[model samples]
Target: MFYDVRRIESYSLKISIENGRVEKVKFDESRGKAFRVLKNGFWGYFVGDVDDREGIYLAEKNAIGKGDVNVLNVSSGGKFTLKPKEDFRDVSVEEKVEFLRDVEKNLKGDKIVSTSVTYFENVRRFSYYDSNGNEVFYEIPRIGLIVSAVAKDRTLQFYSKRIMKPAGLEALKGAYDIANEVVDVVTKLVNANAPPSGDMNVVADSSLAGVFIHEAFGHAVEGDHVLQGASVLANKLGQKVADESVNIYDDPTLREFGFYPFDDEGVKAEKRTIVENGILKDFLHSRETALKFNSKAGNSRAEGLKFPIVRMSNTYLDRGQYKFDELLEIAKDGVYLVGSRGGETNPATGYFQFNAQYGYLIEGGELTEMIRDVSLSGYTLEILKNIKIGCELEFDPGFCGKVDQLVPVSDGSPHILIKALVGGS
Candidate 1:
């Protein structure tokens, strides 16, 4: 029998503020243990409501079946902690409330009609052990604040910004700036017009470009999807799938929201270059998939007390030498899409549609009137070939959801000029 046990614990605090008043304050602490067993080559899992031996017994009972699930022999373990300076625990709740108030006041505007801000901080500790005698443990503290604002004049528009990092109060140093930017963007978006619709040159700002990379290309390279015949890139490994100017990487070592010293399965993090100079090189993997693909394993991850799955951490498109003006010049008569609301993609078909938070029209290679409710869409394989990567890669943090599980992640890219179909949503 092959089995693993996990003990996960967390402490978190959240405060919600609206229109400069505290709306809610919440604090929570939780802990749980889960067990996974492979009996007769079938995997089974059980979480909560049992002591260690009982949990293992139940898991093994469920795992008893005629099946074929094999895992590579990997003996890996470690202990680490990402300690945050000025821990949120040391900061009083009143002070946290006051901090939110100061940030709320930064959302200044005559046209602004509403504002809401939420603060969150969490400390997570995890322990893992397996029948093979491997053990691992780690602790990490994280914090974040989200601010949203709505404005109305000719049209109602909304905008939001968030700052999440693997730190404590110090992570919110730029909260005021984000608040101001949200107000400023939404204020202008109220008067913004719909974009011109067509297949044309489009320049995606870093945030939007990052979204495309994460949502379209990144998902296509997940090992499980590839193995399941659910990815377009599955058969394209070692071949050119993008322009020679492009390079894409998934690295969890960065100190972004997705940072982790090691994944849940005890595999140490490493930079995996999925695409290099246009060729598809590697796919993200868990140990199970790694054996099938003959690739290194590091991306096995999971929500607390959940079974590990293949996942991405900090994924980004490598920067090119082109500047913002150069990308604008390249897309002389198209929309300059900025930010991301959200998007959906079909990895099997490589088709994706994403909504840009807002954008501007480019005429004669210069920014013109603001445009709202813009969307970009295209086949991933084709779109990658059509992009001209720009300089100064930047990251935007958020949660990536799959199969009802969500994990913190960061996506990044420089500006990218591409030809795509753009329209109003």
Candidate 2:
């Protein structure tokens, strides 16, 4: 039998600027502890604000029944912390709001009708102890800025830009640049033509590619999904699943938004290579899932007191050999999709559909004209097998949600060229 306890503290601030004025400001703080015990093959979990010993006793008492389970006989402990060069806690709320107001001031264009800027920061600290003589502590801070611009000509057009990172208040320094880019993008989108509808070669920028790999393929490889037969890759291990030029990895040790030294289960975080040179490799796993599959453990995560589950950290397509320009030349005539709005996927069926925030028509190996309301859809495996990976990998930071639990994550890829179904207005 084993017992574990976790203490968590989080602080966040959000400021919204609309139409060159401060619209809203909010701040939040929370702290709590969660206790868990594994006994007789049954897991018991409880959350409370009581003495640690009492909580552990209650959790152990609740752990009843028996089943087949095995945990690695490993013991580790550590303390890790990242101190922001410019700590957000040291900055006053008024100053942060003022900074956002200045950013909104730059999001102005003759055709621009409305602009909204949002600034957010989060700091989280965690401490953990388990019956196996493992102890750990860590703290991380994250910040993000988003700018949305709306333009009105004959019709209304909208565009947005986001800059998020696992850093301190310093990350907000780019808000002005992001705001300007959003203004320019929305202004051009006001006159952009509708994309053509049909199957065609497509070039995805790093951001779109990141979202593509994360949504279209990443979720399908989670260990829990594989165990439940909910993933297409369930029985495809050691088989070819992608082009020879493609490789994919999920690494929690990367200093990105999803970075973590140790998972909720006190397992040391490490990289998992899901695909290597077109071959299916492994699935992301929790301790239990790893034990079930006779694999290694690392990726267990939870939302506060919720039970830990297999989750992704920094998942990305490994960089290939072709340069961005080379990929464009290879694509010749295709749609060049830029950023992602959002998307949906059926991991069980390997089907995905993602909407591009905006894009451009590629003609004669050059970007010809901007296009709007474009969507890309295809079978995930098919796209992977047909992809032409590129050099110059880049990452984009965001939050990934699974089973109603949201966790910070980063996804990345270089430019990729592939053939898929394209839908337009």
Candidate 3:
């Protein structure tokens, strides 16, 4: 028999300004606990706002059914408290509003008809203790700023930029540059031409390529998906999956938005190599999945009071030897896509489709004109094999959704050259 208890206490704030007007400023607090028990090859789970002993009793009582669920035994214990250089509470709401205004001012333009800015800061305190002598706790802050604008001429176009990190107020130091970038993209988008159709060579910026790998490939490597036979990579471990030049990693230790000292399961975090030079190496795993697969455990994570599940933290394609100019040169006559608006991917089928926020047409190894409504789609494995990676990797932070739970994550890569179908949507 085994048991564990997890609890989370959090405080968060959100402030937003719209079209040069202060719109909403809100604060929130939440706390919850979860209990889990394993007995007779069955597991029981309960989440609530109850005391430790009562929670454990409820969980054990709920473990009345029979199932073949077992968790790996690992001993891990630690405590981490990240002290922000400047505490978020030290900044007044008025000061935050003014700071947001400073960023919004840069979004002004004749073609720009709408603008908005939102700031978020949250601190979560997690505590965990389990039967295997695993115990851990952490207090970390997550901060983000979002700036966006919409431009209209003969057509409507939208652009947005986000700066998020595991730091405190200091992360907003780049507010000026972020707002300027939002304005620049929206400005060009107003006069940009529609994207060309059909399959063609393509160059992807770090942000776009990051999303590609995270959505198309990351989910497919979660151990649960492999066990369920829902991923195309279910049986491809130790086999070649990408070109020898391609290497991918997911690390929770990075100071990006998804930084976590220890996963919810009390596993000490480490960088996990999913693909190493074309070879499928490992999958993200929760304790149960790890035991079944006879693999190591650590990728398990949970939102407040939710069931622990396999998740990616800061996933990225490791940088390669080529430079940005080299990728453009290799793509000679293709679209250079920058940023990602949104998209869809089927991990079971190894296919994906994504909409670029905007792109520029590449003519004769050089950028020609900005293009709007840009999209790229292809088979994930095919693109992975053909990827010509660039030097200087970077990351884009956002939330990832799985089974109705949203967790912070960052996807990143250097520029890349590949071939795929481009469309205007």
Candidate 4:
């Protein structure tokens, strides 16, 4: 039997400013412990208040038997701490609220119906011990600022800017510039025409490309999805999945919002190249899934005491040779999609659809007119095969949800050119 104990200590603060006024300020602190026992092929888990001894007892008592499976050996253990330039705890709630309020002030315009600014920070401490003589501890801190502007004329238009990273309050130092950009984009979107609906070459900004990589391609390469036969990439390792310029990696070591020195499963966090030069290389893996796939374990993650599962960290498409202007020129007659509201993907079928918050028509290698209500839809493999990757890489931080669990993650890419179906209202 194998057993492990995990303790998570978390602190968070949030400030919301709406319409140039402080709307809400909240702070929370929580501590929890989870214990897991591996018996036969079954996992017995228990989560409760931060009492490690009790959690261990309960987890052992709950052990069950299925068949048998062996996990890859990962015995390295140590203590790691991330020292932020500025500690988030040192910044008072009032200061955070005031900063957001100032950012909100810069987002006001006559056509703007409402503006909201939110600042959030989280610090998490993780400690782990296992029966195999392994112990580890680490601390991670993250902060983010989100600014939203809604403009109303004949209809409503909204635009938002997000700045999230694995830093402290210093990450929000440039909040005003992002606020101004959001206001300008929303103002233009308020009067922009709907894009023409059809299939065409398209250029995606870094943010949209990030979401596309995360939702379209990333999930399909998850080992858990492959085990369940719910991924198109299952059984397709070493095959060509994208253009040779396409290189993708999920690196937990990167100092992005998804940075983690060690996974919850006591596995040392390391970078996994999921795709390299268009060939399917590897899948993200937890201990169990790693065992099943005869691979190494590292991608396992959890939120507080929730059960650990395979999850992506800082996933991104590697930068290519083409610059942003070069990509636009390559897509000479297509639309330039910018920013992502949200999107959905079916890992099994590789079908994906995502909305670009706003876009611009490209004419003669230049951005021509603003467009709104645009959605991009296509099969993941098809888009990847048609992709022309760009040189400037950028990352966007957010939360990823799977199996009812939410975890911080960062996804990124440079400008990418592709041909896909574009839908417009």
**Candidate 3 global CA lDDT score:** 0.92
lDDT of 2 by residue, 175-270 (tens): 788888888888888888889988999999999999989988899999899989999889999999999988999999998888998998888888
Q: TM-scores across all candidates?
A: 0.98, 0.97, 0.99, 0.97
CA RMSD (A), model 4: 1.3
Q: Compose the digit string of candidate 4's lDDT tens values, residues 150-184.
A: 89986699888888988877788888899899888
**What is each predicted model's overall lDDT from 0 to 1?**
0.91, 0.88, 0.92, 0.88
Q: Write the per-residue lDDT of candidate 3 for residues 134-239, one digit (tens) a residue.
A: 8999999999999999999978998999999998888888999989988888987888999999999999999999999999999999999889888989989999
What is candidate 1's lDDT per residue for 60-104, written digit by digit as tens? 877757677777667788898988877999989999999899999
Off by over 4 Å in 2: 64-66
Give the least accurate 10-residue stretch of model 3, judged by summed lDDT.
Answer: 299-308
Ranking by TM-score: 3, 1, 4, 2
In candidate 3, which residue pairs clash? none
Clash number for candidate 1: 0
Clashing pairs in 1: none
Model 3 alpha-carbon drift over 4 Å, by segment: none
Give residue 132's error in model 4 in angstroms. Answer: 1.2
Please report the TM-score between candidate 3 and the true structure.
Answer: 0.99
Distance from true position, residue 66, model 2, in Å?
Answer: 4.4
Q: Please list the residue runs of candidate 1 whose C-alpha ends up more than 4 Å from where it truly belongs after superposition.
A: none
Report the poorest 10 consecutive residues by lDDT, candidate 4: 64-73
Clashes of each: 0, 0, 0, 0
